[model samples]
Target chain A: MDRSKLHSVIALDMVEFEFNGTPHKSPPQTTVAGLLESLGIEYRFCAVEVNEEILPKAQYSIYEVKPGDRIEVVTLVGGG
Target chain B: MSTNIHRLSVAGKLLESRVIVGTGKYETLDVMRESLDASGTSCVTVAVRREKLYDRDGKNLLDYIDLKRYTLLPNTAGCFNAKDAVRVARMGREILSDLGNPGADWVKLEVLGDTKTLLPDPVATLEACQRLVEDGFKVLCYTSDCPIMAVRLKSAGAASVMPAASPIGSGQGILNPNNLKIILEYLKSDDPDYPVIIDAGVGTASDVAEVFELGADGVLLNTAIAHARDPIMMASAVRNSAIAGRQAYLAGRIPKRLYAMASSPEEGVITSRPW
Candidate 1:
């Protein structure tokens, strides 16, 4: 197999998604928990929403990230 | 006088303090914490926002707040429509539930109409309130000082109807007491124990006192205490005012009169009127 062809095959395995309104790329089949772990956020302190639907904490480990998914990680802040 | 313990009860939850303060607009987090302590508030409002990434420091608002001391009342402050408000409310519930807080099942629902005055959108507010209530939430609906809207919200199953005294953070201080009075009368007409709280536009201690004296069950404010020249001192004043106003309301103020009646008998008056 050609070396350039092998590199292109690996690139197709990655998924493009939006994390907190910014473009991000991750490997296919990455779970929300895995993504949070890579981001270094303690999942227990924050809430997550994927594609405008709230993802319960129980589903973080089971739900897989897909291409074009919008993810938001939110935490408590000062407000009235 | 017989001493009786008074507490604010809403949707089966009882709070020792009637004054609810917010966690925003403070000059510093340390000052905000101190001001909260000084305010003698048992419940504080917080907002939900996207987490700030790339920061090695792990400090957050929960670090400054003693969760054991104050109940975290999550609010949908910036949402301008019903859909966004409901989503935010759900997110808030999820975070608080995970943390094992008592406030996890409730939300301070605010659907704003615009950004200029920060006034609440009555239509969206009612829509969101009903949705939250049906979803097993003890919704504390924030609305304008419109008695009609207040009554509508209560009928939609709001735990508490919080009417704004003025615009949010305007510091105008109870612009229309008559409307607030009407809200109190209608909401508490049959259900006398219904909690109608004044939510915003408190300028100083006097504003807090007036809210209580007007028979409101409680007052929720933020900028009045947080943005004060001396936030800690302002918090203390607000604390005392809440107590004083509640007492005054219980005491029952005398009726207003255009003509004054002499306290001493007219026969006992020795000096003639200057007029």
Candidate 2:
């Protein structure tokens, strides 16, 4: 596996967070959860939507992520 | 039933159907899809949460539904105050705008003050609704069974006021019909065009029908239909029940009676009990 090629810009919609830039040509078959785990960022109370498609938390293990994907991760916060 | 026809208009768009469904709690995507199709609902509500778009892997639930079919109503589902609701509403607008869906201004404003009952914080909800409306967002406020609050919401420019039949996911079914009826009557008297939807606490199709019969413009249900053994079938039943109830109301129901109706002929004098 080429570590240098695994760099590609990952975008986080949350203002408080940032995806350390895109992951390059790593494996195209990376799971969403695997990618997040690699980044050392664990989202406890959030839901992810890729390219306007909502990904259920349960399917993160099987779902694959690709380059040039606009990802949105929304977290729950307190307020009335 | 008055000969005058009733129409429900939200954000200047007229909807012939009055049943609104929530896209949550289905065991499977197929069941959800089938349920929505059966519900005949033009609008379906969704909640927004924070998560990474592209994680270590693949596609998400957002792709499951055909956005072209049903109207997407983003709700401030977990927000507990007006400020949070405003923030989420802004995020919702941005998400929609970025997606090239300008119609995202329509929001189901929900501000739960308590976690136990998931009750609507009427005061905060109204505040949020007022601000959203002022910001050009078409607000549909989920409130409690308070006529005064409902009236205030209507007056504050809410596109619609959804008074809860009971707490969220409680399946209580119009805990206070008298209060809801009063709210309906007030809306009719003040602004006959105001749309009043009974949101939450609806256990079954009959519950939905009862609300519609009580003169609500529509009903918003999620758990009842989604959690059913046969969600799709229940959705169909709820849809039909809502329509039937609305039609029954339009058809004018007989006034309630204080006593039982006499089964025998009063004047004909039938000699039946010759003991």
Candidate 3:
């Protein structure tokens, strides 16, 4: 979502970052848990990477994602 | 003979069924699940993709097939290079851990040659297999009916070496049986139990039967079942065909002859023939 145009950075305290190779913005949903929730990503279905390091599931809610962090998420899908 | 239940063993692990279905091309998740049930498979193949930002509502694929009930053979389906495949395999393993199922660390490695043929690139596949195996992942590599590559993969500690019967999703069915046969014969001879699975190009029940007869340890297919007019029925047929072929292989067929020999006793048939 293009939330960048919605408000100034200081107003909503939102952070913009790269997710799955695309630009994504959230309300500073700082931690991996909050970022995943804000992205509506099923926590159990995927592996998350913040800034090139694989963030363990146990620390998803603890490891904070910040601006300029390149996050990658992946999951298994239906295909041959 | 006792029905002791023949098992298809791959890298010391015994499979419950000879047919492995893929979780793709099904009209619905229910159809896919039902077809897997009908096929009597204990495992299913899946593709790994980047997660998207959306509140998925409908039943996910995981909802249809429980991970504990089935072995999820995740594949690096769209990967064209070793780097991508390695990255995908790492992510797949991490996903497994994230799901609290760290034991299910199997990945079906496939590095494609092109979009049209959908054949595996030998260089990339072997490289990926070696890397993944070293990284402690059970690699079931998907390659063409290239016997040398199969051996290399087995040497690289791949859990199983899967060679395509034909092009992916082509439904052509064993386009080159000789190559596949050579693969089965070669791999099994090395360890007397090395699993050589055939994936792709299975069009019908007879294809499954023929490949099994050729000594394929197992079959992995998706388009053949999911695209069938009756996916459930096709799944049933494939299950029976696999068993039948396995039995035929075990029972041993008569050797080929130049001409047919009379089955009836010659003395009993001679007098009547003259009259």
Candidate scoring better on DockQ of 2 and 3: 3
Misplaced by over 4 Å in model 1 are A1-10, B1-6, B54-57, B262-275
Q: CAPRI verdict on model 1?
A: high
Per-candidate local distance difference test: 0.92, 0.75, 0.83
For candidate 2, the C-alpha RMSD (Å) to the true structure equals 8.7
Off by over 4 Å in 2: A1-72, A75-80, B1-7, B52-57, B98-102, B262-275
* Model 1: pairs clashing at backbone N, Cα or C within 3 Å: none
Question: Candidate 3: where are CA atoms >4 Å away?
Answer: A1-6, A9-13, B1-5, B98-103, B270-275
**Ranked by TM-score, top first:** 1, 3, 2
Q: Across all candidates, what is each one's fraction of true contacts kept?
A: 0.83, 0.14, 0.77
TM-score of chain B of each: 0.94, 0.90, 0.93
In candidate 3, list every pair of residues with a backbone clash: none
Candidate ordering by DockQ (highest first)? 1, 3, 2
The complex in candidate 1 yields a DockQ of 0.80
Evaluated at residue B82, the lDDT of candidate 2 is 94
- TM-scores for the candidates: 0.93, 0.74, 0.91
After TM-score superposition, the amount by which residue B204's alpha carbon in candidate 1 deviates from its true location, in angstroms, is 0.4
lDDT by residue for model 2 (B1-275), tens: 22323345667776546888887888776777788889888778877766444552333344555667666678899899998898777666655543444247888899988999898888898889889999999998999999999989989998888999988888878799999999999888856867888999999999998998898888989999988889899999998898789889878998889999988768877567768
Per-residue alpha-carbon lDDT of candidate 1 for residues B220-268, written as tens digits (9 for 90 to 100) = 9999999999999999999999999999999999999999987877776
| Per-residue lDDT of candidate 2, residues A1-80 (tens digit) | 35544432222321222232333333456777876676554544344666556666677788777656656656422111
